[model samples]
Target: MHNRLHLTYANQSDQEYLSIYGKAKITENRQKVDDLWSSFLKVWFSGKDDPNLALLCVTIEDAYYWDQKNNKAVTIFKMAKAAITGEKSDTSDKGTLNI
Candidate 1:
């Protein structure tokens, strides 16, 4: 039963990931988001196992390059995390925010 629940959660996560990826892929600027994501991973989180990083990266791409309204939310979330952890966000580094 425990394994079954874990499997279900994994499946749902994969579906959500695919949904986000599909949204980006179908956009007029499809390759831009993917390229930015690849650079982000290479620079900041290479070989890390954090599953939600893709979602965060996609959110950043949409908010910044696509002029989406979610930038405030992302900024607040990052600020909150930094406040709690007392560490500056690596995402603020030069070229990391480029799309």
Candidate 2:
């Protein structure tokens, strides 16, 4: 179960939302609310029992990994450095994995 999902990481999959509680309840899992609860949330919700609180379930399938990869930050840095150094960047071995 997840709340306040800012983002999801899945390629080539359908998306769905499972509201834990009923439409009016807002939040079905009190433990999740407590677990993810924060003082900053008070600004959005009255409290843990706030009617607006809710949980969402995410499902992922058919995910694949890159065959080869470079550190994203390092890759960007290398690209930038290549521009200044006039040297080729080590940008190779990248593709969807078979398994």
**lDDT of each structure?**
0.37, 0.54
Q: Ten-residue segment with the worst summed lDDT in candidate 2?
A: 16-25
- The most accurate candidate by lDDT is 2
Mind sharing the TM-score for model 1?
0.21
TM-score of 2: 0.39
> In candidate 2, which residue pairs clash?
none
TM-score of each: 0.21, 0.39
Candidate closest to the true structure, highest TM-score: 2
Local lDDT at 27 for model 2: 38
Q: Taking the tens digit of each residue's C-alpha lDDT, what string does model 1 give over 54-97?
A: 43222223111112223556757877899999988543321122
Q: After superposition, how far is residue 69 of candidate 1 from its true place, in Å?
A: 12
**Model 2 lDDT tens row, 1-99:** 433323324332222222222112233878897898899988888998877777765432223333224555666888899999999976544333232
